[model samples]
Target: MNVLSLRNVTKTYQNHTAVNNISFDVPQGSIFGLLGPNGAGKTSLIRMITMITGVDQGEITLNGKRLNPDMILDIGYLPEERGLYKKMKVGEQLMYLAQLRGLTKQDAKRDIKEWLEKFEASTWWNKNIEELSKGMQQKIQFIATVIHKPKLLILDEPFTGLDPLNTNLIKEEIFKLNENGASIIFSTHRMEQVEEICKDIVLINNGELMLEGEMNAVKQKFKENKYSIEFDGMLPAHLKSDSFSVVEDTQKGLVIQVKPGHDSNEFLQSLIQEGIHINSFQEILPSLNDIFIKNVNNKI
Candidate 1:
């Protein structure tokens, strides 16, 4: 089931188009990536989805109904810009935001404490927002956003300002939320994170969808049929097979590009018969970053 969708969505500014007639669906209980470079209309699309701004054309639906005022509670948004009051005490600030989300005072306080403890940030509760480090503030904002337990979470550049350790902290929380039944729309330029967590993605470039599909299927579309084989002995000049061409050679192994319709088993057997003792054999897959750059260049 689609938790969120846009049909023929478009946004235009004074003599400029930001998002242009794009449409996509994000399924319930899955992580969806909204990706693009700077000035690529991704921000405009995201704003429209969250209703922070109105669309110039088209319609949006959430949970099979037209998006409306009441639906905002069902969605949580963590924007790139931090919005906490600098002088506000962390715990009090969180409690206020939670109440704004419609959570009762008692429930909000209980959940905020749990989140703080889970992130190992309990010590930050008494500190003012300005006194906390960037990573600490991010953790606080992240906790505040989800304290109400909304059905949908939209995170834009969610991992910004976080170190590797804190980044993973938020990542684990995102995974946990999905496991407990919240659909996430994760938007960022970090393609590796998308590859690691998102099962579905919609990529936009210059106001158009560069691509959108299940992450694995989309990755398959960009495969180059490359493989890395590490062995203990010298490799033969020919494997008696034209299916693969050795692209890189080292003292320990060879990296080859297998031709389309070629049999990898036959190639491996030839290596084996040549007395090459295998240490490791693995297919090489392109990362999303690699594919994203190539696709963007192709479109340009």
Candidate 2:
């Protein structure tokens, strides 16, 4: 069940392509990561999805219907930039934003109260927006973003600033929101967040789709033949092999990048012959950051 689909979407500036023939589908009720480095056109694609800006070519669909004005109410967006009034009272700001999203005053108040309590920020209701910390105000804006309970939520740089504890708090809320059947499109340059929470991802680099698919499959696809081993046995200090190259070595262990077209069994058998005690050995899979670097380099 794909909740959002972009088909051959292309956006161009006066002399440069911002997004080039990008296409991907975000499954229903899943956390989808939209990732890219600075100036990679990821924001352009997101803007097109939210219809904040129109694409020069291609179409975007939500809930099996073409993108339209009515879809705005169904899609709630928290842009990379904050969108709250600084001088307004916290509670008053939320109420105004909620109504703009098409919620009735009574319903918005009820939901805002529940959300404030859930976030344990109900006591700050009367605080002036400028009185709050950046992270605190971020939470208030976050509450407004999802308070309407839209079927689809688009959050860009959702965790830009915060102490670890508050970051964890919002992470918990995001997980809970997903569990309640809301599809989420999480856009951020933070690769670790994508690795930690996203089930699928679409990466764009320099105005083109670099990759898009299940997280697990993408990791496996970009996997290199490598392993990390921890041992204390007296293996030869000057050890080298054609099949395996030492990536890093320490008194405790060694990280080896195995060469392609080599048999793992043969390599291990050689280690056994050399009397190296293998305490623990595990294959090395490319992290999201690693994959991102490889992707950008490939494009270059």
Q: Which residue runs of candidate 2 sit more than 4 Å off their true CA positions?
A: 232-241, 273-276
Global lDDT of each candidate = 0.88, 0.89
lDDT, candidate 2, 117-206, per-residue tens: 988898988999999988898899899899889899999998998889888999999999999999999999889989999999988899
| Steric clash pairs (candidate 1) | none
The candidate scoring highest on TM-score is: 2
**RMSD in order of candidates:** 2.2, 2.0
* Distance from true location, Cα of 123 in model 1, Å: 4.8
> What TM-score does each of the candidates earn?
0.91, 0.93
For model 1, the superposed segments whose C-alpha errors exceed 4 Å read 123-126, 238-241, 269-278
Per-residue lDDT for 205 in model 2? 92
Candidate 1 lDDT over residue span 1-300, tens digit each:
999988999999999999989999999898999998888998788788778889899999999998888888899889887678999999999999999999899998889999999988888788999998888888888998788898999999999888999888899999999999999999999898899889999889999988899998888888898889888756665663678888888676788898888867878887777777888999888889988899888888
